[model samples]
Target: MGTMEAPILTVNNLNKQFGSGCDQCSNPADRRLDKNYCPACGTVYSCQNITFDLHPGEVLGIVGESGSGKSTLMRCLYFDQEVTSGEAYLGPYKEGRSNLFRESSQQKRYIRNHLMGKVYQNPVLGLRMNFSSIGNIAEKMIAAGNRNVAAMEARGSELLERVHIPVYRMKEAPKNFSGGMQQRVQIAKALSNHPPILLLDEVTTGLDLSVQANVLDLIKHLQRELSISILLVSHDLGVIRMLANRTMVMLDGRVVEQGLTDQILEDPHHAYTQQLVHSLL
Candidate 1:
């Protein structure tokens, strides 16, 4: 669904370094084979000057090995972690004028509630296991200003049904469900606000292969049905190929390549990307 139209989300020159940009970090020579780590000063540029755009209804994939900075980038976008330096403008929020990283805490909360929804790699991170399944979804609705309990319950049930969760099981605790069912519940919570942008970080990471396929199918179905812009982070090339229209390959805190998913899979220009592509062959 990518288009030449203005992006729904824009991130320019994003950087997330652990240290204070020490003198050794500034020196290109001190940057070890691991691009993020410095030998002399031990500075870690967890995410190094990343940049990308996510258009309305587009599915953008960030693929990399674990700890390659893709997850760090996702964390920064979700405001779970602060960025070291960068400008992020959500077009559907604040009229795309203010940089998200610079907004006040209250303003950030508003933006999060109104403009974005996120599903973390772990269901525990995204869901309240102690709460009932519908109760978990209700929390997101409550944050978005919904006050009527009946309406929230109805809405939660609808979302649960959409995700293939049984309506009768809506009152059960997520901790009692299978991993796949728990993931579906988490997805329902993320969709509670009907946001224009959704951030998914390795949503299927720890599931079994069959469960992963089913969840991936649900994700594809949601993307088509909702037509929302998606920023998907995953280490699996198969997952990326299955869900992404455009793909960005990250390595050692840097985006080494970006293009259409097929283009990158068929002909990866970067050596790391080539190796990644071949491994799945």
Candidate 2:
């Protein structure tokens, strides 16, 4: 990882909340919440003042239990969900001066199609199950304004094979594939455009242990081979330990601890982080 390199992504004071905040919950200094939810106003803050920088070719893991807002952060970054308030900058986009969260819809779409790729926890969210696996990859390429059909087909096939999808199955729809295979196809599709940033949200969740291991290994291999910067979200510290150079621990929509993966695993400072580390022991 190039710790000294300029960050490919910078996020500042990102926040996402549901419902209009009442007086009690409006002020952060005076707010009282029950695990990210304000009982008085029924407002649920999915993310609060989140900030981080992802360096070029770095794997930044975000680990937290369900409802800890890790997934919400990924969604906001990928523009799958709107941020209530925040700013994100991508070095590969507009010289990193523009706030991604504030970009026009067309510009955001361009960013998604060119600068970033995301693999959702659910294949359904990331893939068109009915389309041919190779077609899914082509879809992203097409979105990025690639109209050369032969070139797209060649690139799509190459990516699928790189992800370990059998060449024979390139034309098959994802719905007929196993969970792990579907994820592999999704990974291939995400990489089709050669995006600089990849957002991976629980990519290996819900698979059999063996299947999960295979997916994780593929991710590790691909990350190294492509030298891509990844923003990975998962509840599994084991997953974080294997792939992340640095880790951030989120709890109740707030980041409680963050540091090198080894340091956090060895000497967790926050109580919640301590619990998470101990559980991995």
Specify the highest-TM-score model's number: 2
lDDT per prediction? 0.90, 0.94
Assess every candidate by TM-score.
Answer: 0.96, 0.99
Q: How much RMSD separates candidate 1 from the native structure?
A: 1.4
TM-score of 2: 0.99
Minimum summed lDDT over a 10-residue window in model 1 is located at 27-36
Model 2 Cα lDDT, one tens digit per residue, 30-127: 88999999999899999999999999989999999999999999989888899999899999998999999999999999999998999999999999
Cα lDDT over the full model 2: 0.94
In model 1, which runs have C-alpha deviations exceeding 4 angstroms?
A: 27-33
- Give per-residue lDDT, candidate 2, residue 228: 95
Give Cα distance to truth, residue 26, candidate 2, Å: 0.3
